[model samples]
Target: MLKHDYKVRTGNNQYEGFLVDLIKEVANMLNFQYDIYLVHDGKFGSKKADGNWNGMIGELISGNATLALGLLSITSQREEAVDFTKPFMIRYITVLMKVTKSTTSYFEFLNPLHPFVWFCTIGALLFVIIVLYVLERIGNINRTDYPSISFKECFWFVFGSLLHGSTDASPSTLSGRILTASWWFFALILILSYTANLTAFLSVKTINTPIKTVTDLASQTRIKYGTVKSSGTSGFLKNTDIEHFAKMWAQMSEIEPSSMVDTSEVGFKKVKEGNYAFIWDTTVNKYKTIEDCDLMEIGPPFDPQGLGISVPTGATYTEEFSMAILKLNDTGRISEMERKWWVHRNCPDYSNPSTDKTSGLQIENVAGVFFILVGGVAIAAVLCLGDYIAKRILKSVKKEKVHAISPEGDDI
Candidate 1:
């Protein structure tokens, strides 16, 4: 591929790969001598704002190379500049990111219910308490067995019922008991729902990632993502009018120093360091991630395209080269070459299938609740001290008033 640096040295120090072999075969059939070399800047050309090309496409347009090969994506923009042979390989752009470890945070308990849901649950509890107090007061107006209940008693009654705890207060009137029963039924359902969701959320170790798709990458600011500069992937991103891709291009272009990298190596290096993602050809990403265990492909590919050899706008070799590539494909030589270079390499099988496993709850999962408990105790201690100090001051004032009122300092 254009991104892969697949090479083998000949006795004369000549390099070889699928493209190299294809070229050699084509030359032999045509009986023409040819020279092979890398593009001047080692890039797949992209059209600059100045209306000129860079990379291998540039070399072809400028008549420096009779044929340009190696993962040269056949795009309409490039076709306008140069003629392309029939596509020899198909590929798509995909995201290559580092595999992040699943994490359980101290606030994992809160993950079950959204903040809005939690707030609404609290509001419902308060509403039930208010309704119960009003109903009980109205029903017990003339009943002496059930004394008037204060706001504090009502709060404790509702709170205890919700927690499946018993309270001393019992409604004597039929209407009061009915309201209490209705509340208990509601509380049971609420409790069951919360428990089920919380259990699921806590049982699974969530993979914390803001990016799962191209839209996710575009919408989030935390991860700085880009593709190789002056490559087909970059060009596709910059030129696409699709909302997410357009937004991503704008952000990449606006940022100083540019998010785009010169090579896939640098792009992937940024990913391993965290808070970055590399977008490039899926084939190259597949090969790289298989080689490096730390790397991973995030999602499916985008902007499906094919790679072809490039020739000058009016080049005479286009038809012959196209035919040669078709012959190689028909004979299955290309498939054999790809298998030899990509699949049979000395990397471990990172593509091995995995099964999901559940892990036991860790201390971190419930640490937030423990911290809240400690904080409540500390706050209660401060309030208790303040209450004691106020009592002592009030006692002292009363003693002074008693002494002033008595003929002499007598016991009051």
Candidate 2:
């Protein structure tokens, strides 16, 4: 709309916006009182195929209104019908889109870790399983009467360690024992990391980039786009020779249930319902989005044109009104009025917001698990060293006793 509800019927026909305020200033400057009325058709203007103009332009040409205001766009076609004051505001056409909540997938179990992460985990498991199997076979060769564990047995043993925290039987060789210990520590950390992230990791995902421009909309079929009917936005799209925009216009014309809407509010409603994009004036789109965190405008606005006051051609006050607008711009009164009308932001920017709480798990959340694992591994390594030392000392004592004995009967 020219304002969200650009012209509101507040208090039996009172209207507001910076536009309303601006006109008041103009009225005061020119020392002329004015009464504002809505164009009965409620359109800015569009030229019909028969060359008849409608909306505010008709009001101006037919002398039904002395001065037409509020979102009356200055166009070449409209210029021929009514004289336009200097453009007080610039309206850019842009896309308004609603972000849909992501649906949980059926294969959400794999969502906890990315695919690359899962692949690496499997790779690590296979590597450890193969190493354990090969080491056991080599040990069997060294001790000729022993039998090595099978590949299947090695896999189940390693997998059991990952799931249940440990295997009942471990390899006999020292190298294989060390590998098993390392795998156990890894399993502990991985389990902790996965559990810590399980709930948070499965939330939302962005499947595609947001449609920020007309070309982005044109390139995709998933989201339907449209603008208000018979407004400058539609006229621009319909009249332009640009390929992508032309495609968009063609779709709007031919699409079922009709993409064109009666009002900006309807366009915005479709966007909210889902898979719809509303292309309209940036200012109105921005106004809607500013107060509702769920709604948003995405752009570098296109097809920027001026919103100007309209009067019949050869009107005496046209120059006076343009100069008044220039005065307001120079004095920054227009800006002041704009801020006053849009009001303060009622909703925070969802895309980039300031918050007191962190939303999801980070490495910091699982770092303590890794620390516990490292400590456990270090203690195990030290205990293994102590055990090896104790074995060697016992072996040395037995050898000395055997060497000192005379005829194996008396102690030395």
Candidate 3:
């Protein structure tokens, strides 16, 4: 209908389409001859601000065409102007976008857990270290059997337990041991949860599209989105009372001519160039995606409608046409036509098979853990250096005091 060289037209000026085939079948059954031609404006029709119609709806109303075929969506507004047959195809408005390659993020390993979860984990680790230090100090006040645990050693023990690493420190008293056991169990559960989630997060190739739904497209500015101008999709957007659609229409109006395209083919080309999404009939979108593997449809239908033949208002043949279309549906001929047009394409399926299976965790998947480990080691090194310098200063002060008391630097 949009003048596709292969699907809609052949080199010899012959026409072909699922809707065309269905219309031919219906004509044969009804014993009527009809001529087919494209709408002069090449539009599905929309009520302009001046209250005039254009495209196929216009053609039908003005008696230029007996009936309009192609992907003419049934709508309440269009119904007011022209009569329509029972829908031959159920269609909905959906977003069409180019299938983008999955790119790696520097912090991709952190994706498994939310940032808040990571913050809480760090806070919990520090809290556990403080609790262990306090418990060990209290136990050491009465017991003389083992050396008292220092704050530094307590920190090291908790950090090592969380990482499932070896540590030099151990709890001597019963209270300290009990606390350590609880911390160890907690760490075990945390590790298991992180590992399981990381596996799934890494295996799935994340598609980072800002526009998943019509609402998403309306809400975002980074991705430019629109529909074919003077088409049913644009008409729906302009007329819808829904808040998001209303906002989107306003935005589209601000952009004017560029935001609205003349055809879905042009919209598809814009999508291929990136940062753009085309909102169009789901049936056409599906056919386009099948024909071009680089394209994909996003989200469920925004507006549920049906594709039907358009005829003049109160046309005498309306009942006969509707009944013929219903008969085609009853006999499964419509489904057969859909299979032939929509599914029987020669395009390659662009989905990656490796992405479907659970892949072994790569170093990048666990890179955050390694970064944390390196950071911990660095902090411990700094603390160790400070502690050594402080101890040395204290020892020097004591030696000087002894020397001053002994009246010389005499050995004890």
Q: Identify the candidate with maximal TM-score.
A: 2
For candidate 3, lDDT tens digit of each residue in 1-412? 4355546665423567787788789989999887777677778787778888888888877789898887788888888999889988888888888876665564677777889999999999999889888888888897787878899999999999998996888888888899889999999998999888877688764445455556777777777788888787887888889998899888877864577788877998898898788888888888888878778787668778888888999889999999999999999999999898888645433333223433466776667778888999999999999999999999999988877674465655
* Comparing 1 and 3 on TM-score, the stronger one: 3
Candidate 1 lDDT by residue in tens digits, 1-412:
3333334543313665567777777787778987667777878888889999999888988889888876688888889999998988898988887766666689888877789988987998899778878877887888887786876778888889988998777666677678789889988988898889888787754444456666788778778888887788878887888998988888887872467888877887898888788888888887777677777776657898988888999878789889988998999988987886677444332232243345688889989989999999999999999999999999999998877775765645
Ranking by TM-score: 2, 3, 1
Looking at model 3, which ten-residue stretch has the lowest summed lDDT? 349-358
Which candidate number maximizes lDDT?
A: 3
Give Cα distance to truth, residue 32, candidate 2, Å: 2.7
Clashes, model 3: 0
In order of appearance, the predictions have TM-scores of 0.57, 0.67, 0.59
Question: All candidates' lDDT scores?
Answer: 0.79, 0.77, 0.81
Model 1 misplacement above 4 A:
1-17, 25-33, 102-209, 344-412
lDDT of 2 by residue, 173-282 (tens): 77788998999999999888887667555432333335644588887777888888998888888899999888889888776338889877788889889788898887
**Residue 99 error for model 2, in Å?**
2.4
